[model samples]
Target: MAESLDTALVPAHVAVIMDGNGRWAQRRGLSRSEGHRAGTRTAKAIVTRARELGVRHLTLYTFSRENWSRPKDEVALIFDLLVEYMKGELANLLDQDIRLLVLGDFDGLPFVARQSLAHVMAKTAHCRAMTLNLALNYSGREEILRASRALAQKCAAGTLEPESLDEAAFAAELYTAGQPDPDLIIRTSGELRLSNYLLFQAAYAEFYFTDTLWPDFDAAELERALADYQRRQRRFGKTGEQVAE
Candidate 1:
């Protein structure tokens, strides 16, 4: 029989690299937007499963900062989908007390998209349930660089001391300031690359890759990922013996 779902070893933070949407659509002879729409539905299911499995933080690789250069129509559809999704999920989010967080640089997005995101964030500020972080218009490298710039500016302005700059200090400037580093990062669609995702934050995260597309990733896949994470020993610089002890 299989082991009971890693209840004692569940990760507090889980991040996912949702990939293969475009390819999924192409294979199905559907519009890329349709794949994204299907992906959103999958997101809801994954969020529910994550909460059920005791995950406190769930981060999704939504839209990358680099995605702005994609086809104009595709980009527009993405924003439209985001707005519709927020409107559709608002009631359910409030009822379930799920906190919504949008990471990355938002300045490049359209005014309407920003407005929708801001509205949802403000309305969900009091939520106490699992935090759902959507990495919209985000890139990990850019995030860390921006944080570094902020630190430099603070020090130059005399608000922060030069000697106070350190790993913890820099980390505090990241968009995921109060959030824990991802303990497990799953990349779907068999992608081996990170594609500019959560570089600083996933320093020691265990990676799980699957051939399943974003829309195809369901509850069983998540359970499998968690199980894989639990079986591996995370030393974080310690020796195996030390970790075991």
Candidate 2:
């Protein structure tokens, strides 16, 4: 699949909304947990593939703030799988030079999950080739509000001027902080909405939606998305002719 793609056109950063796991499992007469397990396998493959394709940043919507609304057992199972994934993939992550970063409230997670993530993250802290961000307990609105409140606090303390706040300053407070904004955002299961994922960072991102469920979204599908991205002309608010020039 990499051989067929234009290397220069590959996105520097890719964000994914892995959706339809429950539906995928339902179609197979399997439990939702089973579908999540299958999706985890797919995530492993996609991470390796993305690294091979030279993607510097890869963010997966692993768990959201709203995901806590799921059934208790299912939520517990998801975190268990998260722990398993972290422990199981630590070696591979180090071998591949991919650093693990979490883009949410770390203290809010279950103790086991927090411990596993902390251990793996520390072990891979020096990795420089790529960064893999797991968006656990993340909410775009909450992040924005958090940033806003931080800036407001600085203002109240007279440490930062209200007039000095700019896009860069605001962005620096985001979870993505120093990382480049995503060039491509892909959502599976044919979902057309952002679902509150990366609302601010995706302002100029090229979106690719597909009917394939998360468990079935493989390397081939990823290649297709990249191919589609390469064919488009990103004007970034400029006219096509201006960009072409």
Candidate 3:
């Protein structure tokens, strides 16, 4: 399937909203934890597929700040699965030359989970082929606020002139600082909204939404999304005639 894709049409950065895990489990009369486990498996496969399809950056909304509002037991299980995944996939990540990057405040995570992430990230620090970002405990609004505060601090200290602030300067403080903004953002489970994911970074991103749940999303579905993206005409803010010219 990857061989069929035109490498030039592939998005440089792809962000996914892996949703509907709990609903998937409910439909099968299984525990939500089981659904999450299945979702994790799907995530792993997609990571490999995306890398093979020439995606340079892949960001997964693994754990959001709003997810903490769910049942505490569920949250705990998610973190446990996260640790297990890190330990299990470290070798595969290294072999694929994929760097592991966190796009959220991982320091606020549980001690054990933090340690696991640190270990995996450290081990994959040298990888250069691709970058995989896990958005743990992340919120777009919070990220913007953090960046704003940092810039404000620099201004207060006279290190940065207020008039010198620009989009590039502001974006430099984001979690995705050195990475390209997402060119494609996919949301599973038929969600029509961004749900506060990558607010600033998604300014001009193309969105792909599917009815399939996160656990059911496969390489074929991903291929479809990418193909759809390739067919679209992205002119930024220019008119079609202007772009054609």
**CA lDDT of each prediction against the hidden true structure:** 0.88, 0.94, 0.94
Model 2: weakest 10-residue lDDT segment is 236-245
> In order, what is each prediction's RMSD in angstroms?
2.0, 1.5, 1.7
Candidate 3 C-alpha lDDT tens digits along 104-172: 887899999999999999999999999999999999999999999999999999999999999999999
Q: Taking the tens digit of each residue's C-alpha lDDT, what string does model 2 give over 1-245?
A: 66778888788899999999999999999999899999999999999999999889999999999999999999999999999999899999999999999998889999999999999999999999999999999999999998999999999999999999999999999999999999999999988999889989999999999999999999999999998988888888987442531
Show how many residue pairs clash in every candidate, following the order shown. Answer: 0, 0, 0
For model 2, the local distance difference test gives 0.94
In model 2, which runs have C-alpha deviations exceeding 4 angstroms?
A: 241-245
Question: What TM-score does each of the candidates earn?
Answer: 0.94, 0.97, 0.97
Instruction: State candidate 2's TM-score.
Output: 0.97
Name the weakest run of 10 consecutive residues (lDDT summed) in model 1: 236-245
Error of 1 at 122 (Å): 1.0
Candidate structures ordered by TM-score, highest first:
2, 3, 1
